[model samples]
Target: MLDLNSSDDSSKRNSLKDPISLNVGGEIYTTTLDTLTRCRDSMLGAMFTGQIPTLRDNCGNIFIDRDGKVFRYILNYLRSGFLDLPDCFSELTLLRREADFFQIRPLLEEIRRYETSVPLGLRGGPLGAILIVKVDSKVRVLHFNLRHGPENYELRTCSVRAFTVDLFCTWRAFLALLCERFSYKTTQGLTSPNPCHPRQNRLKLEWVPRPDELPQEQYDKQNYRGLTVSSPEATWSDDIVNMQCSPCEITDMQGFVEELLKISLAEGFKVDLVTPDPTEILTCTSLRLVKS
Candidate 1:
């Protein structure tokens, strides 16, 4: 609740004073009333509206209990309505924290946009250059960035007019390997609407061809499965389809990725697989990949 008299009293005080001084964590900042109240839903706005009492330090400046160093950026945002980081400023995470504390929606959005920027090299595989595969579930979809020697590959559920039979065969062989080595079981049951099994459960496990420019929301929805193998020098040339190994070679997907990372690192390639979940990271020395 705001007292009308308090508002009038504060207005009178401001009329007789210079630019308001804010002592935020022992740091002094000066700004005008209009700028501070521009975002009416913010805490500063509430303070100006008399809903919250303003506290002052001993030096006769309103005191805010927060980081003095990053306060400049917050004040700058309020003044100019722009988020321009200093040239040497690498403290985005810190600034974002402050923005969140201040409940600034635009500033938080800017931080999110900055954080999701992808690396130049790792942008979705060269368009149409490699087959793209996606596995969908009730909650999300997983994309595979599969490779074979210098050639890249993606999983395919059915033949397409543009792609050749060899690509299909390679993908089929990869499935065969997964079945034999990992003991992967496809979903099996008759469709509720008919007598035919209709590949109902198998549909979830099979890799479906992915189109270029996958939906942004889809990528955000699920974790990605990636492999980082040693570069030109290593002998891990065999693709997932032809990688000769006994059942002991890997226990599961995580184990398989771990073994691949271990082999690649021993050969001196710093391959990294980026995934949304840390628990999904493989056991090998491969570094956890992040997009931002």
Candidate 2:
């Protein structure tokens, strides 16, 4: 009698060399049996080598219950022996879970390496900027041009000033950037309540002006004197008016915003969205950035 075991082994070897079709969660994939069995100790290897039982769909394709969209990455990793993902891909945790289920140690390790290589701010989640500009009480000065008769031709001049009082950011990398480049100091630690990422740590930064900087009152006086000297036709009453003004601590909130956008773009971040639209004002209440 012919050796049935020897004949069966020969047939199995021939099947392993042929192309295999797989239906993973209703998604169809075709590859060679050699690729599936490349990692001898993996779940896929055991299934293809007949060590683990597998079921086939009615269409005669091997069926696997898994996420079909994510399986593309798994198949590509097995084929190329390397993991390559897009720069904007954010589903790393899901991919890691799938790799664990398949018992692919190498893939899991590669994902770990990728996570470590990413920037600290991006590793946590999307980067966001929250800035609030506060304007102090304004001082108005009125000049009466008596030369124009009882019409009281009054010239009204008002100076408005604003400063950044509260600056909050969701990413530490951005906070570090501000501290390194713009001389911002950490004022306090804040915990922001986010629906998606609850209890996330937010940072509040402050920039205090140096004592050498001119006070707001002196600056205003110099500006008014310059205006008086420049206009020879303008007449002023003997009433010497002095308006009360607060000391200047912060002056250029807009400048800070400009530098922030510039550096963020240079560091491979794209603007996700801004509140109140950019056309309305240079300073925004909220801004979000994402890594490319």
Candidate 3:
């Protein structure tokens, strides 16, 4: 529990006269007690109760028991109401943990509400072969023509338009792009080849059964399977947008998609699968997402 002493001493609750220096992990930070106690329920507020023993460094600066570098972010949040993280910020999860430790409810809520402005468009990039989707009721379907070629097994190569970079912190990224592109709830979902129409396939994106739900004995003969983007010899790629990701990448991507579905479905909007399973095998004429 937080050690907040609710005594009648108003002077003690007031901000310290001089600038207070905090030595956190060998890094010295300067701030005021007023700023720290703005959120009275926070751990920092409790620490300044005067009842707690203040530990000082060799240089006589008060010491905090946390990472100094990350503490900068927390201090900034205390000074300013908003959390200004850098573009393409990679340490959101770690920062979230720190926010939790500080017991800053507003900061934690800010992280939860944070959305990436980056857009994920299906423009000229390699796509998964199989996709499973759940959709809202709209019979208008967009058609994609997958032609086999020698290089990269390209699917609908001629129609590519780069929209924006892909660095999504959450599934809200996809939701924003989907809402922006399609006004009437018209967006494409999962992709696969239509074996019924070889040489002239009708590439229709539709929902399919989950892996466990599929019949074990007859699953091998089925034409459509879930897409899983993974290979044993896969290497790390810095280019997240163009790079090919395997099933291992699904932890982040899949979690985002699942969250997207939950939010969309709850809001009375249709949801669809824009990608595939991480462990699915790539095949010709597999389903892919595209703008209509």
Candidate 4:
């Protein structure tokens, strides 16, 4: 006589190798029992292997009372041995819950990895940024000597002055725009002067000439060969003024402030406050943006 227990085992193995239909939250999915049982310690594996009882829908498909839409990803992970989600996928927490219910350790681990890899800015949530614009003025003293007839004359003068403006930031997109337009460098782990605040990354905005613009050395050489030798102090002062006042493809500080506001608004940030709000000034000395 044939061994009855051996025959039963052979039948169970054949059944697990066959195609299985699943009804997950009214969504129908057709997959293989082998895929479902791939994770031997998972709930799906236990159910399919007869270790746990399973319910069936009217159409004879296994009924899972979980989210069917997210189950596709779950099944795909089981089939492909990897996790892949769309860039716009926003159901991380929901998917994690389903993974936990299914007892899929690998899928949970993959989700944790994705969470760690994605930037906090990309994730939808409330965030904040502080913008500070510092302005300073410097005075230069100059002395001139002249000879009048037979007498020597000495003149003391303050011929030129300079104004410097710098922008500091903690916003990612704003910092990126500053870097792209002004060649600013981002500094990480920067702490505020106040000891109470936590350490954070920061960036400073200082204008740098684009590739199309004349290089500093070349410009200096051209100035030296010109009809009048331009003072280095005067040239530096002129550049600072032009960068603040003139507008050329958002090269000016005012244009940059406008772009910052536009970008922040588009990214769901609202202006929280402005320093010295005496008038409707676009380029405020300090600004705070909050997103909710």
Off by over 4 Å in 3: 1-16, 115-292
Assess candidate 1 and give its TM-score to the true structure: 0.40
What's the lDDT of the predicted structure labeled candidate 4? Answer: 0.55
Provide the clashing-pair count of each candidate structure.
Answer: 0, 0, 11, 0
Tens digits of lDDT, candidate 3, 74-181: 889999988887654544545666777878877866665563332222211122212233322122222233335655443221211111112221233233323222
lDDT of each: 0.44, 0.54, 0.44, 0.55
Cα lDDT for residue 68, candidate 3: 78
Clashes of 3: 11
Worst 10 residues of 1 by lDDT: 160-169
Q: How well does model 1 score by local distance difference test?
A: 0.44
Which ten residues in a row are the worst by lDDT in model 2? 225-234
Say which candidate scores most in lDDT: 4
- lDDT, candidate 3, at 245: 26
Instruction: Please list the residue runs of candidate 1 whose C-alpha ends up more than 4 Å from where it truly belongs after superposition.
Output: 1-18, 117-281, 284-292
Flag regions of model 2 displaced more than 4 Å: 1-17, 120-292
Q: Write the per-residue lDDT of candidate 1 for residues 51-124, one digit (tens) a residue.
A: 56666666667778888888898888889988767443444546766776777766666655554563322222
